[model samples]
Target chain A: MTLELSTLVAILAMAAATILTRVSGLFLIERVKLSGRARQALEAIPPAVLMAVVAPTALMTGMAETMACAVTALAALRLPLLAATAIGVVCVAVLRAIGL
Target chain B: MTEIIDETNTGQKPDAGGFMDGAKAILPLIAAVLPVGLVYGAVAAGKGLSVLEAALMSALVFAGGSQFVAMDIWTHPASWAGLGFAALLVNVRHVLLSASIGPKMTAFSTPKKYASMLFLADEIWAIAEMKAREARLTPAWFAGVVAPFYASWVLSSVVGAIGGALLGDPALVGLDFAFPAVFIVLIMNFWQGRRTGAVLLASAIAAIGVKSFTGGAWYIAAGALAGLAVAAFASQGEKTENGETVE
Candidate 1:
């Protein structure tokens, strides 16, 4: 596995793009005049992306995963995030273990 | 601008204990992140990336979710544009994370601020915010907590890479569950408040819908846009409510 020139360039592009995002919030808030609605939207983006990333995969993986995620969501309301995550992972691992 | 300017903590103490405090705060999260980093390294190795590529990404990008997403689509040089777009979109949250910490950070010098940005991540932000609730937060504290987390992630990537090389299959023992499991943990933190549920549903619908129709990054981007659009309305109601309303 060697790094091709295109791959290297792509790597740099990604690094640059990520660096901008890392810095964007601090600077964008200063330059960009945001409406109340826009503020709401920006605030919501992270959670939305979180859903988008996991929802599809969980739905597709199996019934056990869907159930596990639901368990995690419930755990979220009661326990710490890591604890909720542990519950979900354990749920899935157990289901998979039982060949569900 | 007024709000941001108002948040500028002028004449504050440039304290050093934050490093120690932050270092202490992130201990639990380190336990969670270490396994995920190992999984990422193994996944990268499974995908045929050299050790350097895997290590550089973990060290430079330092974002677990975006790194996982990028590696899922990783195919060397050709996948950069697609990877960049998706990863950045996934990282769009960082803009918010940095903003939340930005005011406290305004007290730092320019070079110090820039150096601290390299250590930004969800767990770091959460710990910093949690600490700010009780005491004054310093850039040093933020930087200190981030150090161990960064080391944990990068080191685990190397470890996982070695494990993948030796084991031959990263998912041979169900280690593939790390990605979604990590996301589950993260989303839990963001799951509170009224509008969060609505936004999550809309985003999930958009993501699943787009994924069923297309094969690229459309799902993630579309889901994000859909959620934001819904949020435009939902967040306003939450703000006016004047209380934390959980549904």
Candidate 2:
């Protein structure tokens, strides 16, 4: 499929923005030198950041779907990460197929 | 874990053994990241992007979550300004990730630092932190570990995107499960200790609370904000009881 110039521009811009987001943290952290308290706060950022990304999809996706995903995720936690992800995927697909 | 970092030598040669160890350390992370890469591939292709553009994105941009967000927003009827704004908002979290790793990466050369920053995802950061602590490796070793993982991610993304273009049903091959499964494993790692358990519970609750009020992308920002607030309060309380600041 051929993409429009506008779409390509948007994609590239988005890519640039995303890279900037990841790189910016490393850049600023090295230069700025955060203190003890500030470092603690930084440490806390991941869970919050991840929740910011994961919570919405989990909650908004409906109970069965979310629960299916969550259960599979929980199960995956016990296994290797790859295996766990695979389990979650199969769980979701199978449950969806069975009309759960 | 803390002892490992404290006891190990900070400077070590990057031997064949070290590279292999790095590769093994990153394998699970790669698996976790691959599914998300596939999703990005499928969406990018489905949205009518050419293979070259998608590959370029994987090579140059390399941020998985934000790339997915950008691809989604690209299809929206919003003006370019709106799309840019949305991408920025979705990616603002990276600022936090960068901050978390910044202090630890200070000793590297400019190019090494820049090159290493490319692979600093959640999993990579977590693994690097653990390895750094355990091995007491210098910044160079840290780079050696992260650089290969970064290359692998870009390669997988390109392959996924190309595969998405060729295959009629990429989902049938089970690429869609990567992100959620990876996330689960990551979260499980966090949930191990009591302190981490509290953090996870609080973060999950905060995320759900924010997601209820705001729709779409706002949930991420709100959840993160809520989590920060909660963590700050908890940290301060710990300080008060201990009569000493946490380092």
Candidate 3:
């Protein structure tokens, strides 16, 4: 019900920082021409970044998380996103429940 | 039924397909994000953030990863400078995301494109990039994904803030894995055989290595850069194999 000044300032600052990160890429894209290795690099960004983001959880978290990640990847190949995710979640929950 | 604003003016009125396609495509992610949002709101509440504050942060900042990091580092008499810097570091990946997707938004006008960048959450960007590979990425479609996802995030956070304490640990049921699970699925979608394998391998090695040592958000940048380097090198190998002279 109440908003404090310091919290508001922090939130606004975070918002500003986020907006800067989001929009700066547009400026970079506008300035750069995509071709050759540059195009390859840009194309790789999606997978590379996604892999980077999830790498820790997939490989380093624990046996349960790693196994669930593998299950999800396998299911993703044949199943819809929702089904694959559900299987992964169920796999991890079961694995965790068993004290993995 | 969200009206899709056709940014590419072919004299087309707002069509339902443009928006509906996007909404349908992002529906799965919405399901995944709901729990995550609830967890975030609960976390914020646990960190002593008021319900209004939690809702405001979710509505304004809108990036989940950085918001979580912010909560981790949150303090009374909050340091705007510290939180702001952390937000930048965690979300620096968006630079690559927006750069990759910017040129693909052929359907968006310059203003519209810039506007859309503000809402470029990871799920939205990943889905949009996938769509662009197979079809045209229209503004209406982008709006459809953003609107529902954004609303769900903010609303869920509000609900969590109000009642998250009663929900107890999300991990007991493995709701926490939803994010990485969804990410794994997206990575599978983006897989392009062995070259992608090389990229992923380099990224995973670098990410794990850096995470083990430095430990923070730097692992993401390190892994992403390593992957990019491998890709650039692989492309160079392709050029040489094709007998194309290197510049």
Candidate 4:
């Protein structure tokens, strides 16, 4: 069901949904007490989401992306962030240059 | 009786200097978000969205994860409900962020507090929380972080949208790799020994598994949920942040 709603409507709906989320945690906390485990899980979520976002792309994409991400991950183990990014970018560039 | 805040917690009220102070504080985050904003613009433009539409999404939605996924799945006759739901799920984390900032923001007038939330991003929230721990977290301090980041986000997206036309292929120039690499660094920071590793590994497995099974980016939220479950289980009797083993 594509274009079931107009673009403006869709955008507005998404924004409203996002704002609801922004306010909900605060709103709920006042009435509902979140257990420590719940808070810990929340703390753990952002990284997991990031992992989810990238892991699949690396899997489905071609060598350039995979290598770039691998280099980034490996470099991440030891190097600072910007340096690791450079290494990843360069690795992918080199791989792509060779027609991989 | 008004609850007492310590002296360190009662610094200058948000003043005219608050805006400038915030602008300066966010310089590093501004630099960090710039490329992401550019890539978002390029990606959205590549999807056939008009420049105005892409910029509008960035300005209005202002959530990077949802925006990226939405753009990825965008097609003619778009699935509006799917986009809305996916964005809602991905941003569910913001519920926690907003709540964490809620007590500190109590100092602000209601309108000021709500207005500040409009531009809240992961980085902005982190900065505000950090400020809160250190001392008084003025709404101005929060706005200071938001100002540069918000400007950088919207403007960089505009530049990338316009540049996308001239640049032909963003992937060829290696812009695509930048975000993944950047995220790798961000993810690495969240690393907390095996506990974190286990959660991340499971989440990645769940994500990749779902991607293979369904071929949908919605796996991101699914995987995140999986990790949350794991973290909840892992939390029982875990070591505290201060290196004290909790029973």
Candidate 5:
């Protein structure tokens, strides 16, 4: 219920920054005509970004996390998204329980 | 259904499957993000934020990764500049996401396109990309996913802020692994060929390297740049090969 002035400022600042990132791309699209190498680079963004976000967790976190990532990736090959995520959650829980 | 709607409509026909399709597609993500929202709320409460503050942040920022990072470095009095910069760095990827998907939004009016970007979180963007691959990206479809997903995040944050302590640590059940797990699945879906493999490898290496040295969120930016560099270089090589053949 209590809203600190400083906290409010910080939250607004974060929201502004996020808004800039979200809208800036549309601006870029309107200005730049992408093709060839630029198009290739754009195509790579999705996987690259997703990988970068998770790389530290998947490879650097711990044995349990790395193993769970693998399990999730393998399950994703066949299982639905929810099912694969469930398997990964269960796998990590078990691995942590065993002290991995 | 199309005929029924067409008779009542003046010119714009509701994209028949867009909204429902988006809703159905986003259901799994909604389930996955519930625990995450709860965890974020719990963490905010632990960090001394009131439930109202937590809910406000969730609703406004709506980007989970940077929100977590902000909480990590949250100060007593709060440093708006520092946290804002951190959010910018973590979310810079949205620029690339926007560029990639912006063009696919052929069905969206210019204003609608800009308005929709406000809700472009990782999950929403990912689902939108999947939808685009199959059909024209429509406003109704995007709204469908955004509505339910956004609601879950805000409501769960409130719940977590109010009752998070009773729920205890989420790591006990490994709920945190849900996000990376979901990302891994999404990555697998993005696999195109050897090119994708190269991009993923470069990204992983750079990310791990930067994370080890700097020990912060710079890894995501570094890794993304490295991957983009590789794809650009690979495309350049292809262009050269084509030139040689033309000779």
Candidate 6:
């Protein structure tokens, strides 16, 4: 595919926006002092925010995909994180191969 | 007491142990990011992006999810305005993340802040939060943790892009599974105490809710919002029981 200048620019801009989000947190967190309640809320944010992000992707894929991911997540809980991920990817491939 | 004093003094050089501590703390995070980096590489190549272009994207922008979203938009030939709008929606969460980390970074110089910001990711932020709790805010320790994480992301992206070009259909070999697999691992890492069960329940509900109401993109957003709302409510209840008001 021929590269369009516009596509290139858009991709770069998107990348910048993404980085800004990640860095903006560190930058701002240092400049401002958060109160205790704010701290508690901030602490709670990650799991909640991440669950929101990951849940839809895992479930919407389909029943088999969701189950497969659950198995992987369960395995991740028990085993080393990296190993569980490898196992999950393998499971996905094997299932897809068998027409799941 | 002397050991604690020595540790607290930034002027004293940290021995090899401190470096290793930093490395150990960041390793799992690096592992979590690797697969995503590979997927980014494969997707960019599959979309016919050049090596320099893809690598630069990872290096400069460095946001994994947004990069993937951008790539999806790239393939569709949408208007620049549409692409920008979509990108903004996806990244608005960063404003919150930045706010959480802001106060912890006061000691860093302006240049260091600007440069280090480029390496920020969800995993890195989690790791940095822990580090900040242990040490007084200093640019050196921040760099010690973030530098490796940033390098891993950029390097893996390059590797993934190259691998993507070579592998062709990533799904054939199951490389596409890498993305989700990485998240499963990360979610497990963040799952602790009651938060684990709560997150799982909320996610399951949100997933179903979003899937029924909208397709994938909106599904993700709705699901995330649902999870956040549920967590916020739960946290508020806990605070009330403890005789504190929720902020």
Candidate 4, which segments miss by more than 4 Å at Cα?
A1-5, A77-83, B1-14, B241-247
| Residue A63 displacement (Å), model 6 | 4.0
Please give the interface root mean square deviation for model 5, in Å: 2.0
Error (Å) of candidate 2 at residue B246 is 12
lDDT of 6 by residue, A23-83 (tens): 6776666678875545554554555555555565576675656777888888987888678
**DockQ of predicted candidate 4:** 0.51
Better of 2 and 3 by DockQ: 3
lDDT of 4 by residue, B79-198 (tens): 668778878877887887887787676557666666777767887887787778867666666777887788789898888888878867767777777777777777887787777887
What DockQ, between 0 and 1, does each candidate earn? Answer: 0.60, 0.52, 0.64, 0.51, 0.68, 0.51
The candidates' interface RMSDs, in order, read 2.1, 3.1, 2.5, 3.3, 2.0, 3.2
The number of the candidate with the highest lDDT is 3
When sorted by lDDT, best at the front, the candidate numbers are 3, 5, 4, 1, 6, 2
The DockQ-based order of candidates, best leading, equals: 5, 3, 1, 2, 4, 6
Candidate 6 is scored at a TM of 0.78
Q: Where does candidate 1 chain B have its weakest 10-residue lDDT segment?
A: B1-10
Candidate 1 docking quality: incorrect, acceptable, medium or high: medium
Candidate 5 lDDT tens digits, B23-136: 888998899788778878888988899999999999999998788878767888989998898788778878888876888887677788899999999889988988888787
Return the candidate ranking by TM-score, descending: 4, 1, 5, 3, 6, 2
- On the 0 to 100 scale, the lDDT of residue B29 in model 1 is 90
Clashing residue pairs found in predicted model 3: none
Residue A85 shift from truth in candidate 2, angstroms: 0.9
lDDT to native, each model: 0.76, 0.63, 0.85, 0.76, 0.84, 0.67
lDDT of 1: 0.76
Shift in Å, residue B172, candidate 6: 2.5
**Model 2 misses residue B10 by how many Å?**
16
